[model samples]
Target: MTLPEQGPLRLLALSPFGAPFDADEPEEVHVALANGEWHGNHLHPDSADDPVNALAIIADAVQETVTACLRQVWPVCAEHGLGMHPRDANGRLSWWCAGERLRRGPAHIRAAVGALDTLMPPRRPNRRSRRAR
Candidate 1:
């Protein structure tokens, strides 16, 4: 949290949702780093008036900080090495990739964000029938 403030990005201290500020959740929304040190953007202090809007805005802010300061493409498609982006798939914020394949076609999804570490290993085919034929 020691990081200096980024002036233009900061929003005012949030009141509560529906009380001149957010109304969705009780916890104060903040833009935090992986280490929990937040420097810029306060979630607009009003986005919590609507859950959907708040979620969208917060997601964008988090993604920006992680990708911009980390110097690495976040939530990347490990298989294809392509950068991932936020997309609403199946009513969830999913990490989407554009890796193309012959059978699978284009724009593949790597996995849900924060769940990429659990990707299943690639399956291998059996070669039993080719024995000395």
Candidate 2:
């Protein structure tokens, strides 16, 4: 299946409460890979109501997609070359890098959800800072 441009899959399962999975705003989501092939269950049917829940669900699915199909970590820490995980930064889901750039800072957010491509370019790390773009 081809990955959509919007986000993740939209299987649209009920939340066991009869609420609409998409409510009033239906959208298409892509099946992304670690490199960005996503498939299977989407973030969740009810995440539309709560952004935090949606972000968490999306991050989990993205991680699963990256790990299961690519056999490699997605949104890796370019500086440390280590796999990154998802964490809720405020209300948005951000990639959490486990590597520390210095003492007392072993973890940090790499980028917001779906923004890794912007943060990480096709070249050296020096050219991929969030402030650079």
Candidate 3:
């Protein structure tokens, strides 16, 4: 995803070698920025067994890393303009917005993780109407 001031943002897996004393220990996998900067706890290896759990874990890690390293919210709700958090909506992992709507309650799911682009309106080129011309 592209940030207006930061250019494009890319996330990558970073697995460093385990401690020298424990050569057999598995490497801990972390979500890192393109430049190799990351923050927060490393992803739990057990989470990899479940796709839904894995997505939730990764989303949380990404949010933590982005907020700390970039000093900004990673994904903001389009309608409410508020920062959204990763949450479990039913059985799916989704981005949850805390902003309320007219009788819509206090919170709602904006979109599934990695599907925020679907909520964004399509970009249209500027074109003057015939009347204006």
Candidate 4:
């Protein structure tokens, strides 16, 4: 979850459009990047019935859009440097990495879907200490 300290915030949006198959249905929503660039199927309307399912669906769509449109992996594993995928970890959605740990097996959960910031260590001040000077 080490992001650049300076850059435009990469925000996500839900872009709504008429359902392609049926005009009578509710508008379909696609998870899009801040610029409205997205590449993925519209989120299933039924997913909204459950908060967990909705989160999973939205996360998948956002990942697809970021990966395809931006041409870079989102939420990479800090230890392995590999892209993580959303997975069901005991009924909780988590970011799972394929990279193996020394004794932890073939895969690991990097973090829960919306909790990456918790893993980031607090930043140290930039000023040099008196000992260094």
Candidate 5:
């Protein structure tokens, strides 16, 4: 999608969430490499006004772009080996994993959306961590 104005979308490119990809114009921005191509619409102006909302929007858009353009899930859960989805976790947008019912714990968050590269070993969700408010 074409954004009437550019905002902090460049921030995504600087994080582990996205890498610098070529755009037709310097004013335009796109997410990570997908088959050497970038996809998805530009972030809306209002979402950029708030960090949390912006992250949620970015995570979803990135996932859509990657899945469609690259034909692959953007980030996969290490423990469950399933593709993760973004959900609000205590005001933070996080990657929620649908863990195995038997061996692994129930559905749990893997990590904050942009923190994949810096993730430590997956930890079981305790009552306290699960009930973030």
Candidate 6:
């Protein structure tokens, strides 16, 4: 989908799936579906000026579209198996999830906004060989 040229938002939109860019709106950029339906406010011009704020704003807008239109959580936490929200970690924008157990800590940062793919992919262990052993 069409996003501002500035900052990591454009990269974030392309990383998960290559969201197509469109110029139909004329005045505003949109993060749209394959069918060209996008649900959220256009990226504010000022949001593109700052790296961290840009990511946060982009994440918020994306989440809004996914939740309202798609009817589900966008980037969910692997460990906690819950929806993640954009949170300011230090000066960076990160996907934050409430930790699974209270004793382990209240919450934790899963990954930086445009970096969710960096999390370890699901692995299927070699159960057949292990059982044979």
> Number of the top candidate by TM-score?
3
CA displacement after TM-score superposition, residue 52 of candidate 1 (Å):
5.0
Q: Evaluated with lDDT, which candidate comes out highest?
A: 3
Between prediction 1 and prediction 4, the one with superior lDDT is 4
Question: Model 6, residue 59: displacement in angstroms?
Answer: 0.6
In candidate 5, which residue ranges exceed 4 Å CA deviation? 1-29, 32-36, 102-104, 120-133
Error of 6 at 69 (Å): 1.9
Candidate 3 ranges beyond 4 A from true positions: 1-23, 101-105, 121-133
Q: Which candidate do you rate higher for lDDT, 2 or 5? A: 5
List RMSD in Å for every model shown. Answer: 12.4, 9.6, 5.2, 5.1, 13.6, 8.4
| Residue ranges of candidate 6 with Cα displaced over 4 Å | 1-26, 101-104, 120-133
Question: Runs in model 4 with CA error above 4 Å?
Answer: 1-25, 101-105, 122-133
Lowest summed lDDT across 10 adjacent residues in model 3 is found at 13-22
Angstrom error of the Cα, residue 91, model 5: value is 1.3
TM-score of each: 0.52, 0.57, 0.72, 0.70, 0.62, 0.66
- The per-model lDDT (C-alpha) reads 0.58, 0.61, 0.77, 0.73, 0.65, 0.66
111 in model 4: Cα distance from truth in Å?
0.7
How big is the RMSD of model 6? 8.4
Ranking by TM-score: 3, 4, 6, 5, 2, 1
For residues 1-133, could you state the per-residue lDDT of candidate 6 as single tens digits? 2222221223223221233544443345556554455577776768778978877877887787667766877778877788889999988888899887756767989998877755756445657655644
Estimate, for each residue in 11-73, the C-alpha lDDT of model 4 and write its tens digit.
333435532455555666776666566688887879989977887887788778777877888
Q: Candidate 1 — worst ten consecutive residues by lDDT sum?
A: 1-10
Candidate 2, superposed: residue stretches over 4 Å from native:
1-42, 101-105, 122-133
